[model samples]
Target: MDFKLTEEQQMLQETAARLVRDAYGFEQREAFCQRETGFSAEFWQQLAELGLTSVPFAEQYGGFAGGGVETLLIMTELGRGLCLEPYLPSVIHAGGLIEQLGSEAQKEALLPRVAAGELQLAVALEEAQSHYQLHDVLTRAEAVEGGWRLNGRKSVVIAGHSAGLILVSARTDGQQHDESGISLFLIDPKSDGVRSRSFPTMDGRKACELYLEDAFVSGAALLGEVGQALPALRYQQGRAVAAQCAEAVGSMEAACTFTLDYLKTRQQFGQVIGKFQALQHRMVDMRIELDQATSMAMLAACVADQPDSVERSRALAAAKFIIVRAARFIADQGIQLHGGIGLTWEYMLSHHAKHLLMVARQFGDDDHHLQAFSALLDVA
Candidate 1:
């Protein structure tokens, strides 16, 4: 596949880079993290105003109907700045699910608002015991008179504290760990029987633990067909994984830049450390990893919007596995090259390193994807 960016894609990348550079200074990012929402509402609105948030949705809902390449462009820029916005959860994950599965009325009521940045959404899929398994849902949703009544706890729900709506997965039919009976429900976070405990992640983003006790959602809240939500959930998650790989690539790029700059200026013995052949070789290794990751990220983006198939799944898993390993290597090497300064909170490289580490853990760690790839290795 061709790797060249089109004229429009280049323009999108430039716009995103410029906006992030102008708005996401280190001090500004720290200030945003101090807020209740853990990100800049103003910057999020700026993304909406600039049409970045609407890149992947249908034009009828005020979106650009752009595809995976567009998402790659935007997410890479966001990763560079380490922007703390909920774009992944609100726009990409939840919005994609709605567009993919919502009824006409549901899409009409939600997508426009989401495209306009009027609504924020979070997804709750991980339980205490689930680890990284998406199908290990223990949350139960029993059919009630007009809708479903849900009861369960969701752990480490990214951006759950500030979401107006949350998409939750629960077992409505089969036993735990069975993929056949899982269902998706859109729930109002402020409704009765729901509670949230908010906290900051190691990388400065906000997250929450959610509890549901008889949480009621209308029948309209069901996304896709009953007991058939697993396929869509897994499919959309692949898209998310691809986008995250792009983000990690951006972060890796930043880390490499920071380390190279440090090596050039920092004196050790009689000369700058960058002059040392050993350090130079290490930097070269980091660059090689970064390039590999960038290629894999692009490959993942190219396939993110394709129809569901074993090939798609295998490609995504491979992308994620390679990217995760690259991220971990870059993060560790960046810190090691920088020494004590890299660990300081005041420095941007430290934050980038932390973000890279977090990226490895999200979606799935390196091992998780390796196993997934192994399982689908013979599909071709």
Candidate 2:
């Protein structure tokens, strides 16, 4: 199959790259992380003004109707900059769910504002015990007077502290771990009975632990149909895994670049470290891992928006597994090559390494995806 980017894709990639390069300098990123929101509000507005926020939605909602490739391009640039914005959680993951599962009225009410960046969103599907299992929902949503009362806790909600709305998953019926009874709800984070404890993640992004004690949402807040959100959740998460792989590739690229630069300039006993045969071999291994990661990222992007099927799921699992392993290798090797300077807070390489490490933990870890891929294998 052809692997060339279309002219429009190329333009989108360049626009995203230039925007990130100009706006996300190392010191500037540090300042952004210091803010209460843990990201640059001005840069978020820039994304809205430049229409980058609308890249994935339908045109009727003031978006480009772009798909996986477009998302990959934007996320790669974001990753390279070590940006702390909640683009993956807010725009890609939550917004895509609304587009896929929301009713016409829900869409008409929410999509435009989200696309315009007037509102931010987050997903709250993970429980403390769920690990990466989307179907292991224990949060309960019981039918009430005019809506539902939610009761349970959501853990590690990325950007949940600042989101205007949170798309939450709860067990509306059936037993825990059963796939048939899960449901989705759109909840106002500031509503009564909702509490959040916010903190900074290792990668400098903000996240929160959400507690819902009799948190009531109106009937209109339900997304898709009751007791049937698992399929869509799995599919959208597959897309997210694809986007994340691309982001990892970008971080790996930055890490590799920093290591190579350090080897060339840092003097050793008598010469630059780049001249050392042993170090040169290590650098070559880092590059090889990066190239393999890039290829897997591309493969993931290609299938990210495809119709759901066993093949699509298997491909995504394989891509994520490979990318995760590669990211860990590159992160370790990058820091090793940089020596003491790599661990310093002032260096961008250290930050990139942290981001790479965090990427391995999100969505599903390397071992998780490896098991998933193994389960999907054809054994005929």
Candidate 3:
């Protein structure tokens, strides 16, 4: 397969990079870090104006009709800029889940709003102890007269405070973590008994711990059957992990460029620091890992749409593992090479480092992906 990006992808990449630099520069980013919402309304509106809200949906669904490739390009650019927006979780995770699993009416009602960026959605799936396990859900969902009553707590819910709709995971049967009990729900965040408490994240994104005290949901809230939500959850995991890899590739690339220029220009011991043998080797090491991560990210992006679950999972896990390992090295070495300046908030290297750290924590750590890879096949 030709790995080259099409003309449109390249153009979109450049456009997104420029928009992020222009709109979300250091001062603006710092402002977001201090704000209660941790997201810019103006920026969100600008994204809506740019039609970014519509990229992954089909044209008939009021979207730009772009698929995984287009979404990947946009996400890469967003990562390159170290953007603090919630596009991937809001659009890709929540929106894609809706597109993939929601019933016809469910899709029609919510997707158009998602496409237009009018309604923001967040996934309230994670529990306290589990690490990206979809089938091990503990949130309980009981059948009511007309629909269902959802009573469970969700941890690490992305964009929970700002979302209009929440794609929640709940247990309908069985006590322990098993396949039969877990299900997905699309409930209003504003519904009675629903509460979202904001937690300050390392990155400038508003994540929350959600409490659902007898939250009522209609039959339309059911995203898919209890047994089928795992597939959708897996798909969501793939998109998130792939997007993190893309972001890491972009951020690490920028970090490399920045470090090289710093070394080349800065003088130490009567010569340019970059001329030092140790630093040159460090740069080479960074390049090697960065390129490997880049290649794996592209592979995952390409195969993310494949119908075969094993092929997709294997590729996705590989991408996630490689990116986590390489990005950690690059981020650590970048900060170390920058000396004390990297430790300061005034320099953006530290900023990028923190964001990269957040990326490592996103779907799961390197260890989690390693185990995930092992679990992919029961065979030796």
Candidate 4:
């Protein structure tokens, strides 16, 4: 398998890395976190100018026609900088869904605005009872006189408060746990009978719990088929999991690099900690974990690019399992090896660690992915 990236891909990766290094410093990130939106409009505009917001879409939709590898590169760079932008929710998830499943009219109205940073979207899929089950939707979308009426609650909606639009998942046909009958709807966040309560997440990001009480939407709001959206939704989930693994790899890389640099400079027992054989071994282990996790992330991206669902599921689950374990290990060791300063809010490692831990639970946690991987193998 060829792991080499194209020149265009390399340039995209470099550009994203440079942008984050220059614009997402600790102070800038802190300021963004303090804001209610949890992101900077200026930074988002900068990303749009760089053509990043359009990476995952087709050229017809004003995008670069990029794929999983492109998404992986962008997300890894964003993770390295601890960027709090809603790129994952807006671009990779909701925007990608629209590009894949939206009608011609819907794409014409939405994708361009999303690429221009004029519209941000968040996905409301998770319910309180649905831990890591993608199809466990309790939210209901019933056929009404004009279109559809939504009545249910969605929890932990990423970037929900700031999103101008939301893509909500609801059961339109079958049972709660059934894969069929799940449908997605494009919703106006400020629509009547819709309420959202926003809060800060562990990684200093914003999320919301949405309560929809007989909220109404036109028939045009329905995406894809009414009761056969599971496949498209699963495709989106695969891409999201791959992107997340890439981000975790980036976070682990940063943590390990910071710890290694500190060990080389910080004096302990009148000598640099790097000189201590014991500390050197620990750093080597951290470096190994980082490399392994990076490989797994690449594998995930490649597998996600495959046209086969079984291949995608098995590979993504395996990649995420490795990423979740390595992220926790790398983050914990980074703080422990750095001594007390690593825990201080002033140190970026502390924040990176927090962010990495948060990523573990974003799409699914270690146990979830582990179980998924095992199940896939069993079926195989």
Which candidate model has the greater TM-score, 2 or 4? Answer: 2
**Residue range 240-315, candidate 1, lDDT tens digits:** 9989998898889989999999999999898899999999999999999999999899889989999999999999
> What RMSD value applies to candidate 4?
1.0
TM-score of 3: 0.96
lDDT of 2 by residue, 1-380 (tens): 88789999999999989999999999999999999999988999998998899999999998999988999999999889888888899899999899999999999899999999999999999999998999998899999999999999999999999999999999999999999999999999999999999998998898999999999999999999999999999999988898889888888888999999999999979899999999999999999988988888888888999999888999999999888899989889888989989989999998988898899999999899998888888631
Candidate 1 Cα lDDT to native: 0.93
With a 3 Å backbone cut-off (N, CA, C), the pairs that clash in candidate 2 are none
Question: Which segments of candidate 1 are over 4 A away from where they belong?
Answer: none
Whole-model lDDT values for every prediction: 0.93, 0.92, 0.82, 0.90
Ordered list by lDDT, greatest first: 1, 2, 4, 3
- Per-candidate TM-scores read 0.99, 0.99, 0.96, 0.98
What is the number of residue pairs that collide in model 3? 1
Query: Model 4 segments beyond 4 Å from truth?
Result: none
Tens digits of lDDT, candidate 4, 142-191: 99988999999999999999999999999999899998999999989899
Better structure of 1 and 4 per lDDT:
1
